[model samples]
Target: MTEHRPVNITGLALKIPPALIFILWIAMMATLRYIFPGLNYELFLTPYVVGLFFILGIFLVLAGFFSFRKAKTTINPRKPEKTTAIVTSGIFRLSRNPMYLGFLMWVIAWAFMQANLVTFVFLPLFVFYMNRYQIIPEEKILLSQFGDIYYRYLNKVGRWL
Candidate 1:
């Protein structure tokens, strides 16, 4: 079941910033932890897990950001059409959506930090929403802008490895 939403309510396919959506997911996870305090578990390696994921998360985000900067492409998710180049080096070589993957890692860190099973449900939801509303639209714009070069890169990398 999807929302009774109009297709492209404006010329823009994206309405919300991905960062804001990430924040919303984090907020929802926190709310779930508060409302369902009993849904938590004991993880002896919680600190290690959280730290590793947090570090990897930040690393991937920065790597993606820097790669975009070096490639002279638009890093702004709101303007995929403005992307001047298709970056497939560094972190981009691993995942097409490295920044989003980093965000997912941060979400994982938050879930483990809470030690709450309920909050973990947002993981798949986050992926689903991002693929449906964010990545697909961005891919369309990239494909239109960069054509087969973008298509080849899409085939070469996993969306969220």
Candidate 2:
């Protein structure tokens, strides 16, 4: 029998938790808002728009969480290798990363509530950071774990929709 070694697919050395990253981005957005007070400009029915997005974000997150629970797979973002099964049903079918997408929506809602154009800059930054440090690493581990099945799923689904 040959010995097998687990591959270190996550190239990132600094593994910041996704929640912490979210908080940090929120802080950065707030700081930007404070720095550029003149940038604040509200839209008509801004509160209602913010509320709609917030509720939608919350719904997506809950849907993703419940789907993972029903699949009996690990939802912990940091431990993709521990994911026992590939979740392809429910919200997972719509977007491969519904939880992250939900979080992105929440950030967008917050930015809208802030009514500052400068705060909007953090949205793309959040996506870039998640893609580089979180999503890519997780995908590498999933591909290593589930192989062709995961590849097929990846092809079938959008990363964020």
- Return the TM-score for each candidate structure: 0.91, 0.92
Q: Distance (Å) between predicted and true CA of 155, model 2? A: 0.5
Give the C-alpha miss distance for residue 47 in model 1, angstroms.
0.7
Model 1 lDDT per residue over 9-105, tens place: 2442567888999999999999999899988899899999999999999998999999999998888898776777889989888999999999999
Candidate 1: minimum summed lDDT over ten consecutive residues — where?
1-10
Worst 10 residues of 2 by lDDT: 1-10
RMSD per model, one decimal: 5.8, 2.7
Model 1 spans > 4 angstroms off: 1-13
| C-alpha lDDT values of all predictions | 0.86, 0.86
Pairs of colliding residues, candidate 2: none
Q: Encode model 2's per-residue lDDT on 46-79: one tens digit a residue.
A: 8998898899899988999999999988888987
